[model samples]
Every structure is written in C-alpha cells, then in structure tokens.
Target: MSNLVTMTIASEAFLLLSFIIIILSTKNPKRNVLWVILFIIGAAPHLYLAIDHVTNDYMDANIGLGLAFMFTWVYSVAAFIIAIILLVKKKRDNNISQEQ
Candidate 1:
C-alpha cells in the first residue's frame, strides 16, 4: 500500500477509536465496545493484508505468518482481558446496586 493509504488508514483508525471511546464512555458501564473495536480494528487489516500477501506471494511466507500470528495473538489477548475486566466490573456494579 502507498504511504497515503497507510496514513489514511491510521487516521481513520484513531478517529474511529476515539469516537467509539466517547460513545461507550457515556453509555456502557463496563466499556466493552472499545476493546472489541480495538481488536477488530487492530487485527483485521493486518490479517487481511497478511492473507493477501501470502496468497499472492507478495511477501515472504514467514513474514506474513509472523504478522498474522502477532496481531491475532495480541488483539485476541487484549480483547479477552477486556472481557474479563468488564465482567468483573459488571459483577461489582450488580453487587453494589443490590446492596442499596
């Protein structure tokens, strides 16, 4: 991809992430949206490009595999951590509300 496209994608990612953060901040008690969005935005493009590169033989197979593995692992682990935290927060919120 060209530098312009890369920059545009990065800009879009930041804008979208910020927008989602704003929305979730007000409405979501546990803030699950940002994490999920982070995973999707962070992983999908690299995975897609990696797959494309592998299929088209545009890059070395090991490099493509590395990119895929790194993104998949990092994003998935982050999302899972987010989920766990959200669950904990929800449990706490429920306990507090019930105690009132």
Candidate 2:
C-alpha cells in the first residue's frame, strides 16, 4: 500500500527476473546462481529498510542506513567488476577452444 512497499516489491521482482534471465542465458547455470545469491545478499539491507518503513512508517536518516546504502553501492560495483572479468575470461576460453 505504501510507496516503500511498492518500491521494494518492484525491486525484488526485478531481481528475480534478472536471476531468471541470467540462468536462461548462460551456459553455466550454477555459477549464475551464485551471482544471484550475491545479489540477494547485497540487497538484503534495502529489503530491511523497506519493511521497516512499511511497519513503522518512519524513515530515519541514520548512520546505519547510510552504511547500508554504501554497502549496496560497493556490492554493485563488485558485481560489475566480476561480470567484466567473467566476460573476458569466457571470451578468452572460447577463443582458445576454437583454436584447438
């Protein structure tokens, strides 16, 4: 009912959809599952904040929230870096296999 609830649901749904897409599109489903898990862990704080907002209807600009946001940002950056590494490794492996 609240905007926070709606946003949280939408974010979680989007993450689920992303996980599905990663699993379907990748040759390595197991590895993608790990990625999804990492993403879920990274998003846990945001999820908690959303639930807090819904139940308490109180949004506090506190240090904990700031830390959570920072952690989320760090996770996002880490994910992006890891993705790039994986892509490069995959491409190199493909090239090597092709040459052989």
Question: 6-79, model 1: which lDDT tens digit per residue?
Answer: 54355445544544544443445465565557556765766576546545644434565456556655555554
Q: Which candidate is the best by TM-score?
A: 2
Give candidate 1's TM-score.
0.53
lDDT for model 2 comes to: 0.63
Q: Candidate 1 at 52: error in angstroms? A: 0.8
Top lDDT hit: 2
Candidate 1 regions exceeding 4 Å error are 1-37, 58-60
Question: Model 1: clashing residue pairs?
Answer: none
**TM-score of every prediction relative to native:** 0.53, 0.62
Q: How high is the lDDT of residue 53 in model 1?
A: 52
Candidate lDDT scores, in order, read 0.55, 0.63
Deviating ranges (above 4 Å) for candidate 2? 1-27, 54-60
lDDT of 2 by residue, 16-84 (tens): 554454454457766876867777797898778656655664454545645665666565565555555
Clashing pairs in 2: none
